[model samples]
Target: MTFQYSRSFAHQLDEQDTLKEFRQWFHFPTNAVGEDQLYFCGNSLGLQPRTAKQALDAELEDWAKHGVEGHFHGKNPWFHYHKFLTQHSAEIVGAREHEVVVMNQLTVNLHLLMVSFYRPTASRYKIIMEAGAFPSDMYAIESQVKFHGFEYDKAVIELKPRDGEHTLRNADILDAIEQHKDELALVFFSGVQYYTGQLFNIKQITEKAHSVGAIAGFDLAHAAGMLTYNCTIGM
Candidate 1:
């Protein structure tokens, strides 16, 4: 089913939206000529919340007032600041607080996960991923394979859409797993394909990988915040 949009339609939507009042909580950018630009880049970087300034100012005030003791005594203590962010983050990813941590940037965390999960064995040491994964993920996986003393070409297997197709079929992915069952060690794919916006059937893929005695994981950068679902369904 296709949908159409126009200024009038958008206005109607804005009028009916329950969260319309929350629009006042942002600072949308204006052009040099002082006109508000129609910003459409939230997929890259979200607009700053209007509350951010007040939040930061409060933190600054706490720091100035408490100095070294602010780590434990501030209104929002710096010592456990990241912990405060974790509950919401866990809810976003559909994970337990213990399973999630806000640490390094995306690729850095990917590399760290690879170190723990990419334990290649002698007979089954191959890692499968999407053909056009984000460059950072590709680089991280390549480096991980090399770090574990495997050649890039031999260690990494990239699944591509079949000829004349733009998106991968679930059957194709299952076939790849079946074909390489003996050699496959890990099956990792993006939860959502960044380019095509394809949300992979994560539960199905994970089940297939497990059936083939392979470990499965996902990069959830694109899937989070836009959709409501449970990650626990796959497991």
Candidate 2:
């Protein structure tokens, strides 16, 4: 689609959107005049879905009736709740269902994953990631390396764009991974850079890390829902 810089153009594009009607499924905040406010804060937290209250109420009623047994007795058992979400969540992230687990929130899950993947040893322990990753990522990586007896400054290789550039180039990322291949334990990156809105090539990054004998992990908070998995992948 050609770019246009007018509200009418935006409206026309919206009109043509196949999923435009899905807007009614969410509860948008209204202004003082009771007009629906223009919203762009979804990256932080999404607008509540229209059926959210009903869903929550059902779970509340189930809890009231089943008590602690709700884990195994409710319509949606709490014990296996993540299993029910696996397929849908996998599709959103373009991953296999078995590879998905819809459990804890981002930071919690990231730390849990680090426990399994960020195994630092005498030789290979460094992590290469974008310089301006989300604060959660920075803190999580920092804490993980520190916990494993590595200095944050020395263990983490933060990649930034070249001078006067806005976003990082794929070549630079791969080169960094190669440059530190011997010391690289993890190539952690954000699927979509939060600040710049630059989408990284996940498949290439994953393959590059694997090629360098490093584990690759991506924080896909902003990518899921906002981005589409249109590229072909090799089996």
Best prediction by lDDT: 2
Among the numbered candidates, top TM-score falls to 2
- Number of clashing residue pairs in every model? 0, 0
Off by over 4 Å in 2: 1-6, 230-235
lDDT of 2 by residue, 150-179 (tens): 999999999999999999999999999999
**Model 2: worst 10 consecutive residues (lDDT sum):** 226-235
TM-score of each: 0.88, 0.91
RMSD of 1: 2.6
Where does candidate 1 have its weakest 10-residue lDDT segment? Answer: 226-235
Reference-based lDDT, each prediction:
0.85, 0.89
Q: After superposition, how far is residue 214 of candidate 2 from its true place, in Å?
A: 1.2
Model 1, 1-235: lDDT tens digits are 2345788777787798998898788889999999877878776688899999999999999999999899989799998887988999888878888877788798888887777777898899998889999989899889888888999899888999989999999898988989999999899998889888898988888988999999898888888767777555212
